[model samples]
Target: MLADTATIVARLTEFLGPDSVVADPVQMGSYLNEPRKRFHEKAAAVALPRSVAEVQALTRFAFEHGVALIPQGGNTGLVGAQVPLRGDEVIVSLARINALREIDAAAGHMTVEAGMILEEAHRIAEAEGAMFPLWIASQGSARIGGVLSSNAGGVNVLAYGNARELCLGVEAVLADGRLYKGLNALKKDNTGYDLKDLLIGAEGTLGIITAATLKIFPLPAVYETAIVNLASPEAALELFYTMRERAGMRLNAFELVPLIGLDMQMRHGMLDKDPTAGPSPWYALIEISQPKGAKGGLLQAGLEAAFEAQLIDNAVVAESLADRTRMWAFREQMSEVQSREGASIKHDVSVPIAAIPRLIAEGSEAAEALVAGIRAVPFGHMGDGNIHFNFSQPVGADGKTFMAGAQPVHDAVYEVVLRLGGSVSAEHGIGQLKTALLKQVKDPVALEMMRAIKQALDPRGILNPGKMLD
Candidate 1:
């Protein structure tokens, strides 16, 4: 039931003017290409709506004319959710609709248009003497809408929580061009069904998010970060418990990084010097925030106890801002460093915090059994139990050959994740990548409710048709 590309582009041009419509396939590359570079389907056209009214007009036209519209933000998403799947849909980029509407530092929230970049949000908060705790690596390019849409969780999720928790409410344009203004900064609203949450992580299937009121916090007085050496995930697990019991909410990040990660970064010249104390099988990037009027050395005290308990053998606390930045770079550059080693298979899976040790040990063993000499690079938010389980190809294996057998490796990891009551897609939403896996692992009742919600909200199936549900 899709119209021809030329007709669709012409109609969209009439609806939003030629400046807003991009019909040329060559010009559409930027909107079509996503982070993974796995999907290649071209969109019919890209529409840049500069205002909420323009977005409504386009959505109404799509609903009435039976056109599929894929809502996109910064297009930095890894799961191909913001990009097209069928090549018949039009991409509705919110880049132009970006505008700040309100700010209330006292209430700990601010409203910004969907098009504004994530890092800009951080700057805005800091200008008001506040802090927006979400800090994803792609903050420079990822926008507020896409971050909320994906319900992104960065290194600080252990402290401030994910995008969903940080978001108080959102303004969205539902299918058929109806505006659903639900923006509110209330701390307690026992309202009927929570619609804000439904659209936040819906991947634009339910509606297109236009703006949101996001939570902000008072800027912390100091951040104490460190790189600690551990023998195994079990040792890291014990250290995590020790630190969490001592620090509580003051603990911001507890990331896991394998010794291989460090070696790769150094060989690729990504790091000038090794951040860890010395050679250990694994390392944990532990960090804590010292609020204003709060005493320092909290992290040092916790690490001291850990060392005494034999949970950690050695550590190096960041003494300067430059040192803290280097320590974090070692953790954030994990994905990029993998490419230097050639072919890699990655999984963003999470398990119950207590079961993390088993998940890593068993998942690594299974991957090795599937392909010998497979270098396991399992690391990530150890405190939150979300490990970026990844593996590089054998020492001299062919890249294409190893990638060809990535499915079994993925199956192996997901098997361990599900067995431990873990999630296959944590932080990153199930874009087109894991739709099949979602259906297989998700509870049947949850699947039914998701389908019912999608059908109810998007009756004609015009908004992101064939995505999440399909």
Candidate 2:
């Protein structure tokens, strides 16, 4: 039998201390309120363990009593992974366990506790003249543990890989309270099985990540940025190919933005001034990093080549630091400006690099067919073929009414993604939001393998119950 709310709270308080437990629902707002505001189930209590020993004790107690524990970090996740699925579960927050364990700047690696904020990690690495290349919108509040658990893929994924690639090792506590100390700085290890890779993207269904050894790089000398005008997704694809062939690995980011995004941001007063050269149907934000002893102007030359090939007509390269900041601000704020417009239906899906144009055209057509005047605002890491395909309600439509019919819109988009041999989720993991969708679309054999692994690691289903596989 499962434990009740009072029992769960009392057990947590006894394992840790009264100071580490929050039993009052009114004071648990921060832990319950996720970014999307979709999941509303209240947790039994919030446990803030200060060290690994405390975490192990709490887990052992929960396991013995058959209590469900949800591991959370920073509470900034988009899906309901970090929040409670069942109302009686206890949330084990890692916010107070943050600490820098080790750093080897010369060897290009550092180990940090999972509760450390991603922005703070970047600061520490930069202090040692090194850098972590994961750049996401929620880095300010997103913790290292959640970032690795979700296997987040940011804009720089075109050059630097996703969170799984950036991490060399991780330390996690299994469901039975046994610590899996896998932290290492080795570049090559021919082990029996890659358990580190398994836990990184399991969405806490297998184990709770405590700390991670992350890969760092030498600080770049300068970053060349720009916003280029494109006729359509086809033209942007052509430009992306041209830029990649020219800049090669130095190409850091290639993001796609629509003209409607610019208009919305300008109308909402989100931007002080226009960042693009002029109005066009679509725009691409391309950037390249220059290392020490390397000359700049790679972005300018690539744009010049694209112009000559008739792929782009006009562009504005960042001439100063402020220009670069403004250009990035425009790209990163695409999702926020949509909320100001009205209710929005969002999808974080990916397709092959060559099938992006088709994905956009067909997906937009299908959504518009379902809901008239549904403004299709599709934009994201075009370099990696992952687009944040979203739709805004018709002007002056009731927000709640439009959201009520969101399932048909989601079905329309996912159909197109699957038909094009793409993924239903790109950067975001399969949290409670997409559990049914994953079971429906995922291969039968693959799903069986995932379940076997989950059972092997967390036999009691105590770690993050009802997430991912459920």
Candidate 3:
């Protein structure tokens, strides 16, 4: 019983008010254009709900009318979860639902609306002399709902954990508009089923997250940062073990970047100057935090141990604030700089921390064998074993031509990842991009349980239809 586009839009306007609905396709650009320009199906209309009650009302209407509702936040998700897959679906933007309901820095938690910008959440925590450690490249525009929905992992995940761990509870609207008011900030509550965990990473397929109780931490006094040159991913892995043993929880970030990434950034002038020591086959960017009243220089001491073990050769420790910023810029710019090179094949896969070295080595070898002269740019959270395994097109190769042959490369990488007991997706959840891949790689039993959960929660399939399970 799919409703016509005009009928749906008119009904939405009738209840949500004409000003809240965007019926014209052109004005819906902001909602449809995802981080990757890959998903392009036009939404029937974009609904800007201003409150949780409104979101519930809209969900109920869509459920009854048999209109699919795609929950959206800031439209910054790399996967196509927040955008429409089929043209008949409605894009329900939660951007206007932004609100800060409560804050208790000493209690180590804050309650915020889903539409609140991630960076703003950071500011709110900092204002109370605390910190919300969840950080991604798109923090400026990414909203809380999208971040929790994706269960996003950022550079600091080594110390703080991903969104699932960071979130204490969530309040959401079900497919039939019933409110699941689970936004309690208790540190320990094993009362019943973990519904908060389910909705946090469902990619909006299970329910629409309206607001959440997110964990916050005390601000560190200072940070020690460095960029060390490693000979290979194997060396980087060894160095990571050393840093973890030495720094413990203070070791916040351990990122890996290849020589090609630095070269691309240099070629595109993305950085003001090179951050690492010149001409290394691979580099490891490390950072350890110094808490209030704690001594610094732990990282320097650890690096000395690494050098004594012959784990690293040359290193450039950040001498000032500018130096540290530049060092991080080098790691964060890895994804952006790839666009300047040409078409690229990207995979956000993770192996067991021990298998990361083999994963990188074998995956790179396979891709090189697949496309002669293909530039292998494997980099990312070395500590967590989540590599942003990516490959640039061969020099002078047409971008479209290289992208055309991406399927085999993807298959090659996933085969290595799976063989090494790695997940096809690490931090980034499976949206429309990897649903097909998930079907092949995921265990049949696990798949069945996931489908059962979705069917039970969203029987009508009106919430993010044809996503995740499908």
- TM-score of every candidate: 0.99, 0.99, 0.99
| Whole-model lDDT values for every prediction | 0.92, 0.93, 0.92
Better of 1 and 2 by lDDT: 2
Query: What lDDT tens digits, residue by residue, belong to model 1 across residues 37-99?
Result: 889998889999989999999998899888999999999998889998988999999999788
In model 2, what is the error at residue 168, expressed in angstroms? 0.1
TM-score of model 2 vs. true structure: 0.99
Off by over 4 Å in 2: none
Output candidate 1 Cα RMSD.
0.9
Candidate 1: give the clashing pairs: none
Assess candidate 3 and give its TM-score to the true structure: 0.99
- Which ten residues in a row are the worst by lDDT in model 2? 1-10
- Across 396-441, the per-residue lDDT of candidate 2 in tens digits comes to 9999999999999999999999999999999998889999999999
